[model samples]
Target: MLVLLAAVALTAGSVSAQTAPTQDRVLRQGQKGQGRMNMTPEQRADLQAQRLTKQLGLSADQATQVKSIALAEAQEMQSMRSNVMAGTDRRAAMQSMKATRDKYDTQLKAVLTPDQLTKYTQLREQQQERRQDGMENGKMKMKVKS
Candidate 1:
């Protein structure tokens, strides 16, 4: 009876362990923009600057510049998003958003080295692909549900 109880306990522990969230799962949830909307523009800028610093080996000056640009971009984006939510024409909003992004990219290029710019471009492309894949997956899931 004791041996059987021990085996049951071990099985229960293993099952719980299997059900526990992994670090990767947690990171994925965060990456899905959970809680992102609540962050202040400064917070968003800081996060972006930190990521760029890590990815591009940015100097302190460069990071500062990047943070400023990110802050401005974040604020602009927030305004644009609010405008769109308030019934502004989506096509016009999208065009404005694209122009904002282009301006931001130009500012970034001025701050980054040539190699860093290349790397940043690649990273942006990867992000775009991921976004497209995520949208496609969402559409597939919606279709499946229907």
Candidate 2:
């Protein structure tokens, strides 16, 4: 009876251990990027600069410049979002956002080497594809619910 109880306890422990990571993964996926939205502009900029540094093998100077640009862009975007939320015309806000992004891209291009720029372009395209796929999937899910 003691051996049987020990085996049962071991099985239960193993099962819970197997399930814990899955539960943690689900929670992580749900909360991913939500915390970033709550971060200050400087924090967001630092995060972006770090990501770019890793992705593009940026030098210290490049990383610093990127961080500066990212901070300005984040602040501008936040202001734009606030304006929209405060009943500003969305179309104009969108245009202004696009202009801001264009300015950012131009600045980024000046900083990156040609090879890095090419890689960055490819990365952007891949991200756009993923975004499109996600939107399509979301539309399909919405249709299924309706």
Best by lDDT: 1
Q: Count the backbone clashes (under 3 Å) in each candidate.
A: 0, 0
* Ten residues in sequence with the least summed lDDT for candidate 2: 23-32
lDDT of 1 by residue, 1-117 (tens): 999999999999999999999855543454556466777788778778878998999999999999999999999999999999999999999999999989998998899999999
lDDT by residue for model 2 (39-92), tens: 778877877787788889999999999999999998999999899999999999
- Residue pairs that clash (backbone atoms under 3 angstroms), model 1: none
- Runs in model 2 deviating more than 4 A are 1-31, 139-146
Q: How close is every model to the real structure, measured as TM-score?
A: 0.72, 0.72
* Ten-residue region with minimum lDDT total, candidate 1: 25-34
